[model samples]
Structure formats: C-alpha cells, structure tokens
Target: MHRRRSVVLTALTALVAIYSLVPLFWLVVNATKTQQGLLSSFGLWFGDGKFALLDNIRQTLTYDDGVFVRWLGNTLLYVVAGAGGATLLATLGGYGLAKFDFPGKRAVFAVVIGAVAVPGTALAVPTFLMFSRMGLTNTPWSVIIPSLVSPFGLYLMWTFAAQAVPDEMLEAARIDGAGEFRTFFRVSAPLLGPGIVTVLLFTVVATWNNYFLPLIMLKDPRWYPLTIGLNSWNDQAQTVGGQAVFNLVITGSLLTILPLLAAFLLLQRYWQSGLAAGSVKE
Candidate 1:
C-alpha cells in the first residue's frame, strides 16, 4: 500500500512539472519563429526553415533605439533597490519582533498580520493617491518606495528568527560586551543566513516580476520596467501604425526569464537549506 502511494505521488508530481514547463517550452519554441511564422506555426514546435532565433534576439535588444536596454536597466535598479531594501527591513524588523520585548509589541504584530492578509492590489489605488500627493508619482521612487515593504518577508523572517535564533546565544553575546547592533551583526545575523537568503530570493522575484504597480505609477516610457515594457510591445502588435514586433515580444519574454532562472538555479541550494533549517527547531 505504501509503495502504491509513492508511485501515485510521483506520477502526480511529474504531471505538475510538465504542466509548469509546457508553457515555457512553447515560449522558447515560438521565440525562434518570425511574426508570420508564429501566427501560422504549431505553438509547440519549430516552423519549417524558419529558425530566426538570433535575429529575433538582436531585434529585441536593439529595437526602438534600444529602449529595451533602458527598460532592463530600470528593472535591475528597481529589483536591487526594492528587494534589497525589503530584505533589510524584514530581517531587522523580524529579528526585533522575535528577540526584543518592547511596549506595543503585540499591537505591532497584529498590524503586521493584518498587513499580510491585505492584498497588494487592494492598496494600489490608495498608494497611487498617496504617492501622487507627495509628488512622487511618475518617478522611480513611486515603485521603489512601495516595493521596500514586504509583509510576507517580515512574517517569514519573524517565524524563522524565532526558531533559528536562541535567547541563550543572544545573552552570551551581551555578556561579551557586544552592543545590541553588534550582537545582531556578529551573532544572530550569521545564524539567520538561511532565512535571510530565503527572504532575499522571494523579494528579488517579486520586484523583478512586478508590473501593475509600476504601470500605474510610471507615465514616462523611460521609467518602465521589463514587465511593462514587454507588455507595451504586445500592445503595439495589436495597434495600427505600431510596429508589429510579435517575434521581439516573444524573444524578449524569453530573455526576461533567463536572469530569474539563473538566479534560482544558482541559489537553489541555499534556498533549500534555509527553508529546511527554518522548518525544524534546532
């Protein structure tokens, strides 16, 4: 009976993997075709004698006076600033909530929990209004400032810190004449590596793929991230007098995913270790 259950679970896992990968496979296949070929060809396979993968990539990078490059740069900036800031805030705040006992700690935890329950989409309009009133709308600050706050990251770090960081270790650090900040940096922070990496990966992916926030905040094409920029190409393909760069759009999508894929592949070991360590009490 156990053997049969294992087989069933393995089969289900394989199905889920295929379901996720099939669309990525199709995207890669279609990215190699011309706009006409993409419209005419089977989505899952290459078109006959129509391997224009290199040309599509060239055009995607060089199109519209290299606006794609600018978009890519903008995306990198946002990801680095937003994700990095979010991770720092989450780590510090979570550690504090886990280790320190201050007045209003329960109130703060309640607020954080409430924030986690609230969907970001629900806050978008209000955030827009607030930023606009502050004259931050249409600026990169409009995206970066808001992206710095990650409720889920805080929650994850809070839980992980509670388990990973022990009161005995902190007390020892204090005994060694280490200040609170020094103790955190020297003792608690190192032990929190797995949790920090986990939160960093989450925030990086979130900032990289963020679209709607940037879309509503940014008016100038110069400030657009890769998500909004690629989408604009798709929108252009449907409009009269706009360049029908469908091939570029598909190729660009493939290019956009490559960094994220690379990041995951490179960090998979750390992420898995962190998640595993955080899950169990030592």
Candidate 2:
C-alpha cells in the first residue's frame, strides 16, 4: 500500500512539473519560428522553415531603436532599487521584531499580520489615487515605492529570525559590548544569510514580474519594464496598421525569463543551506 501511494505521489508530482513546463516548452518552440511560421505551424512543434531564433532575437533587440533593451534596463533598475530596498527593509524590520521588545510590539505584530493578509491588488487603486494626489503617478517612483513594502517578505524573515537567531547568542554579543548595530552586523547577520537570500529571491521575483503596477503607473514607453514592453509588442497585432512582431515578442519573452531562471538556479544553494543551518548540535 505504501509503495502504491509513493508511486501515485510521484506520478502526481511529475504531472505538476509537466504542467508548469508546458508553456515554457511552447514558448521555446514558438520563439524559434519566423513570423510566417508562427501563424502557420503548430506551436508545440518546430516549423518546416529555418530556425529564425537568432533573427527574432536580433530584431527584438533592434526593434523600435532598441526599446526592448531600454525596457530591460528599466526592469534592472526597478529590481535593484525597489526589490533591493524591499529586502533591506524587510530584513531590518524582521530582525528588529524578532529580537527586540518595545512599546506597541503586539500592535505592530498585529499590523504586520494584517498587512500580510491584504493582497497587493486590493491596495492598487487606493495606492494609485494616493500617488496621483502626490503627483507620483506616471513615474518610476510609483512602482519602486510600492514594491518596497513586502509584507510577506517581512513576515517570513521575522519567523526565520526567531528560529535562526538564538537568545543566548544575542546575550553573549551584548556581554561582548557589541552595540545593537554591531551585534546585528557581526553575529545575527551571518546566521541570517539563508533568510536574507530567500527574501531577496522573493523581492527580486516580485519586482521582476510586476506588471499591473507599472502598467498603471508608467505611461512613458522608455520607462516600461519587460512585462509591459513585451505585452505592448504582442498587442500590436490588434491595432489597425500596426506591425505584427509576434516572433520578436516570443523571443523577448524568452529573454525576459532567462535572468529569473538564472537567479533561481544560483540562489538555490542558500535554500539548501537553510535546511542544514540549525540541524547541528555543538
């Protein structure tokens, strides 16, 4: 019975993996096709024509005086500033909440929990209205400022900090005359590496894949991120007399996901490290 259950679970997992990968596989297949082939051939299979992947990529980069490249740069800028800031804020806030006790701590926890429960989508309109009043709409600040508030990241870090950082270790740091900042930097920081990386991954992904916020906030094509930029390219098909660059759009989509995949592959070690971090007994 246990063996049968294991087989069933394995089959289900395999099905889930396949389901997730199918779109990526289709994208890869479609990216290699020419515009003509894309409209003609099956998306899951290669076209009879030459693999136009390189041509599509070149056009994607060179299209509209290199708007895709500009979008890529904008995405990188948003990720660096918005996601990086969010991770830093989350780490610091989480660490403080986990380690320190002060006035209104319970209330603060309640607030954090409430914030976590609230979805970003629910806040978008109010955020838009508020930012509009402040004249921040249609600017990069609109996206970056909102991205900085990662309630989930903060909560995850808070829980991780509670477990990973020992009270005894903190007390020892205090005995050694280490200030709050010093102790955080020297003792707690190293131990929190995994959590930091985890939060970073979260923020990076959130910032990278963020579409709706930037879509509403930014009107300038030059300030567009990859998601919006690619989408605009795809939408060209609908407009009268618009150039159909679906092939370039496919290639750009593929390019957009590469950095994210690389990030996950590179940072997977931190997650692995987390699992073994507190398992050893001295």
Candidate 3:
C-alpha cells in the first residue's frame, strides 16, 4: 500500500510540474520568433527559418529609446526597497510578537491573520485614494509604501521565530549584558537567517511581479515597471500606427523572469534549510 501511494504521489508531482512548466516552455519558444512568425508558427516549437532570439532581445532592450531598461530599473528599485523593507519589518514584528509580551497581543495577531485573509486587490482602490489624498499618487512611493506591508510574511516569520528562537538563548544574552537590539542583531539575526531569506524571497517575487498596484498608482510611462510596460506593448500592438513588437514583448517577459529564476536557484539552499528546520522542533 505504501509503495502504491508513493507511485501515485510521484505521478501527481510530475503532472503538476508539467502543468506549471508548459507555459514557460511556450514563452521561451515564442520569444525566439518574430511577430509574424509568432502568429503563424506553432507555439511550442521554433518557426522555420525565423529564429530571431538575439534580434528579439536586442529590439526588446533597445525599443522606445530604451524604455525597457528604465522599466527594468524601476522594477529592481521597487523590489529592493519594497521587499527589503517588508522583510525587515516582518522579521522584527514577528520576532517581537513571538518573544515579547505586550497588551493586546492576541488582538494584534488576530488582526494580522485577518489581513492575510483579505486579498490585496480588494484594498487597491482604497489605498490609492489614501495615497492620493497625501499627494503620493503617480509616484514611486505609491507602489513602495503598499508593498512594504506583508501580512503573510509576518505570519510566516512569527511561526518560524516561535519555533527557531529559543528562550534560553535570549535569556542568556540578556544575562550577559546584551541589550535587546544588540541581542537581536548579534545573535537572533544570525539564527533567523533562513526565515529571513524565505521572507525576502517571497516579498521580492511579490514586488517584482506586482502590476495592479502600479497600474493604478502610476500613470507616467517613466515610472512604469516591467509588468505594466510589457502590457502597454501588448496594447500598443493592437492599435493602428503602433509598433507590433510582440516579439519584443515575449523576449522582455523571458528576460523579466530570469532574475526571479536565478534568485530561486541561488537561494534554494537557504529556503530548503529554513523549511526543514521549521518542520522539526528541538
């Protein structure tokens, strides 16, 4: 019976992998084709004599006076600032909730969990209005401010901190004359590395791929991230006199995901260690 279960589980995993990867495979395949070839050729394979992968990439990066480069830079800025801030706040807040006693602790946790349950998209309009009232609309702050708050990151760090950080270690630090901030930075921070990496990765992906918030928050082309920029290309393709740069769009998308893929590959070890450590208690 165990053997049969293992076989079924392996099959299910394989199926899920294929389901997730097929679209990525299609994206890569189509990214190599020209706009005409993309429309005419098979989506999963190369077009006959129309392999323009390098050209498509060149066009993507150089198009519209190199607006794509600006979009890429904006994305990097948002991800670094937004994700870094979110992870820092989440780590400190989560650790405090786990280790320290405060009035209304349960209420705070309950509110945080409830925030996690609420979809981010639902709050976009209200958030936009609030930011507009503060004269932050149409600016980078519009995107960065909202991206900094991560309820799920807080929850994950809270759970991980509760399990990973031992009271004895903290007490020993306090006894040895280490202040709260010093102890957290010198000791707890190192122990929390894996959890911090996990939260950072999550927020990075969230901020990197964020579209709806930026779409509503920003109207200027200069402030657009890759997501909005790519969609604008798509929209432009449908309009008269607009460049049908579908190939560039596809290549740009392919380029956009490379960093995320590299990040996962580079940080997989830390993420795996965090997951494994969190699953077992000492």
The lDDT of each candidate is 0.92, 0.92, 0.93
Clashing residue pairs in candidate 1 are none
Which prediction has more favorable lDDT, 1 or 3? 3
Candidate 3 residue lDDT tens string, 1-282: 999999999999999999999999999999888878877885688889677899989998899899999999999999989999999999999999999998999999999999999999999999999999999999999999999999999999999899788999999999999999999999899789899999999999999999999999999999999999999998987788564777787899999999999999999998787778668865
Which pairs, if any, clash in model 3?
none
Task: For each candidate in turn, give its C-alpha RMSD to the true structure in angstroms.
Answer: 1.9, 1.2, 1.7
Off by over 4 Å in 3: 240-243, 275-282
Candidates 1 and 3, the one with greater TM-score: 3
Query: Could you tell me which 10 consecutive residues in candidate 2 have the lowest summed lDDT?
Result: 237-246
Model 1 quality (TM-score):
0.95
Count steric clashes of candidate 3: 0
The alpha-carbon deviation from the true structure for residue 4 of candidate 1, after best TM-score superposition, in angstroms, is 2.6
Q: What total of clashing residue pairs does each candidate reach? A: 0, 0, 0
List where candidate 1 sits over 4 angstroms from the true fold.
Answer: 241-243, 273-282
Error of 2 at 144 (Å): 0.4
Cα deviation of 260, candidate 1, in Å: 0.7
